[model samples]
Target: MDILYLMILCSASLAAVFLIIFIVNAKKGQFEDDESPAVRILFDSGEIKEKENNGNKKDEKEIGENNKIEEKSE
Candidate 1:
């Protein structure tokens, strides 16, 4: 049917547009940093530890404040 031919042409045009976009991105070094993303997880543990330390410090400060308030009330 004529509608089938129209659908085929539309799909082919869409595929060609996507292919062109992909080729442009590939030439621009968009996919060059493929290793850093995988290895970043290994380095992020230090940041997590730092955040935990900061959180512990905050908790200690809050407890100290609460103790001071209790002493004042008593």
Candidate 2:
């Protein structure tokens, strides 16, 4: 039927558009840094650990100050 032919043409055109978009992206180095994202988390944890250590030191200093205040009040 004529309707079948029209449907086939529409699907082929849609596929061609998607293929062109993919080719353009591939040429632009979009996929080149795939490894860095996976490895970035590994390196970021060290920075997070450093921050946590600094926070703990501040907490300990505050606790020591509170204890001193309590002793003086008693």
Candidate 3:
């Protein structure tokens, strides 16, 4: 009875705090440009050149080399 009331009050206070913070930050434009991260990865990094120029095929070459190096130690 009293415990349930205390728990509800505590949760309501926490929710109010979070809601206020969210509204304040939202008005300040903190989340305005959310799409930038998902779009940014579409651009190339230097790894594409290594894969193309050497026919290195990064995924297979990297995994194979790592396995070979580990095996040599035993």
lDDT of each: 0.79, 0.78, 0.81
Q: lDDT (0-100) at residue 13 of candidate 1?
A: 100
Where does candidate 3 clash, by residue pair?
none
- Tens-place lDDT per residue, model 2, 1-74, is 99999999999999999999999999998877888898876553546645766677567777678657756966
> If ranked by lDDT, best first, what sequence of candidates would result?
3, 1, 2
Q: Output the TM-score of candidate 2.
A: 0.56
TM-score comparison, 1 vs 2, better candidate:
1
Query: Local error of candidate 1 at 27, Å?
Result: 1.6
The window of 10 residues in a row where model 3 has the poorest summed lDDT is 49-58
| Number of residue pairs clashing in candidate 2, backbone atoms closer than 3 angstroms, sequence gap of 3 or more or interchain | 0
Q: At residue 17, give the lDDT of candidate 1.
A: 100
Task: List TM-score per model, in order.
Answer: 0.63, 0.56, 0.56
Which stretches in model 2 have alpha-carbon errors above 4 Å?
45-74
Better of 1 and 2 by lDDT: 1
Better of 1 and 3 by lDDT: 3
Clashing pairs in 2: none
